[model samples]
Target: MKQYSFNFSFEVLEEFKKLLPVNRSKKILKKYLLNEYVLSESLNDLQEIISETVIQPYWMTEAEIIKLDRLIKQAKTKGYSINRSAIMRDVMNNLVDRYRNKPIQKSKQHRQTFKVPKGIKERLSLLIEDGELTYELSSFIMDGYVPSNDFPSMRNKDQEDLNFKTDIEVFDKMDEISSEYGFKKGGRAKIFRDALNQFEAWLESDPPKKAALKQELKYILTEYKNVENISIIKEEINKYLKE
Candidate 1:
């Protein structure tokens, strides 16, 4: 991911208003400027959209999935019309972004401030004097003190995205692989890619170096007997020696 420089100042607001007809006060422009943009991307390469996608599907057993449907329904019940994939992307991005300074190398992470109240600066000082209040504490103390700025950087924004794919099945498989491996949300594809690279190096090794098997491996080999099922996507992996 890359860092971006955006003009989120009053000039952007004024300039945007110039393009529109029947506009009113600068207050309207200020609200528009402060609005949180929905993170979105096109499934097809030939379209552009907002929180909405150009268009977007699914599978997996009740035992082998992340239950994304439950999340989508929750969002719907709360009045959001976004698709499940986007919801998942947003959730993953938001989680990662929150702890970004401590994130793995090359992660797209950032936060956004959606709604803040008036006199929050004064309120914050009062809380600080009352005890030691932080942005975290203040979040609960006073309801409208948003202390972050959002970026849609985690999701694909354009045709240049390498991770961009139109196939919903790819994301489904990712979810399944994530569940099978006990990986965190949105991390399945990356871990699988790393495993493939490691396996490729093993394939090219002289006599294929034998590493010590940890208990995790022992458990997988003995108890988690789904290795054969997993190898369907890469059958050659099953041909390797276990010892």
Candidate 2:
């Protein structure tokens, strides 16, 4: 038996943890390494990789190692030489694409009718009459029109800007997490980590603590929008608990 290791970020690692809960890492890697098309694509991606900083061990059987060596030699002969890390990186990346949490489709923007302050409504009407604005008054306002320097100031010292109530839609917080944490596309890993953390806590905590964690998990299930396959992961968690 031979063992191989590859460095990957926390998110990449977590994605694999959830995606292959029951399958061995070697089995997955062997499948990718033996595939000519997948191996070539993974090697091609190495040219632009900045490299991940976390190293994790993966075991490989003797026969799997032999096949990987052959593939490496073949790729080198074709002038597509790549290191083990590069190949593993591409393998993990492909797995991420195949198993990453997909966004749940939500409704598009819908028009909501609301009354504007008399002063603001009058101001909008005047703008329409001046031929400076083209859209209907409600549409223009709802579209979040910003007053330009050429236009008169909509705000005065005594009057505040009018607030309009708009329909609240199911919004995915993963986008914000990605931006805030400097993750380009791995924010969905947070959901998996959080859910697992809550389950772990529930397992060890006192009654009061368990009660809090229970509520926290429920809140997480409700608050984190657009995560698919959550229930499948939950089933895996349940299986672990039963064991």
Candidate 3:
């Protein structure tokens, strides 16, 4: 069996300690692997780590590598560079996927105790925190968002048109819409925001006619499966109706 080792920063390992289940299982590993942005960020962090680093090691037989070569090919076609780190990451991801087909173990053998690095909170409390941030982080992971490299001085120009009070506020709106539509719960906010990006103009237009607003909203709801494009729309329409 060939052993593969992936390096992680102390900080990134802390993040995994928070995000991963206390009783580590291949199932949870598969979930994170499917999150493109999380995987991307993980790989990026490994490259950026200049201080203390940790090694996460996994072993694989030659047959296992050959069996999962298809996934590596698919990733390459999607523009992911073929590198040692990428190959090892994909192999680990593929094993988790393959494990899904095996019979579930009744003896809890699948769940192993995860050793969190120093400076992290206790496992029990971390799980509680994970409950709150999972949805938010999952939103980023599924969306494949890579952070912009623009300097802090240029941020105002990029966000001058943003209407949301905060990024969390945007995710909160997505959570609500997801519940109504029974769709990508906790993820639709970004998608919808980008879809109806004209909300600023729509809100400040002359007269702000309630009837016209409803007509436009009705169209959005139809296309997006009964979703409210954004919370501000409903609030503004209600205020306009009263006037």
Q: Which candidate is the best by TM-score?
A: 2
lDDT of 1 by residue, 34-120 (tens): 343233343231111222121101112332123445544555665556454454334333333443444322212222222222344
TM-scores of all predicted structures: 0.20, 0.36, 0.25
lDDT of predicted model 3: 0.39
Off by over 4 Å in 3: 1-3, 31-53, 59-68, 78-80, 87-243
C-alpha local distance difference test of each model: 0.31, 0.44, 0.39
Off by over 4 Å in 2: 22-26, 35-37, 41-43, 101-243
Model 3, TM vs. native: 0.25
Write model 2 residue lDDT over 68-104, tens digit each, in one string: 5776777787788766666666677777676666522
Clashing pairs in 3: none
What lDDT does candidate 1 reach at residue 238? 55
Error of 3 at 152 (Å): 63
lDDT of candidate 2 at residue 80, scale 0 to 100: 84
Better of 1 and 2 by lDDT: 2
Residue pairs with clashing backbones, model 1: 111-149, 112-148, 112-149, 112-150, 113-148
The order by descending TM-score is 2, 3, 1
Model 3 per-residue lDDT tens digits across residues 84-183: 4454444344444454456234222121122222222233223223333332233332332222222122223323222222234334444565555555
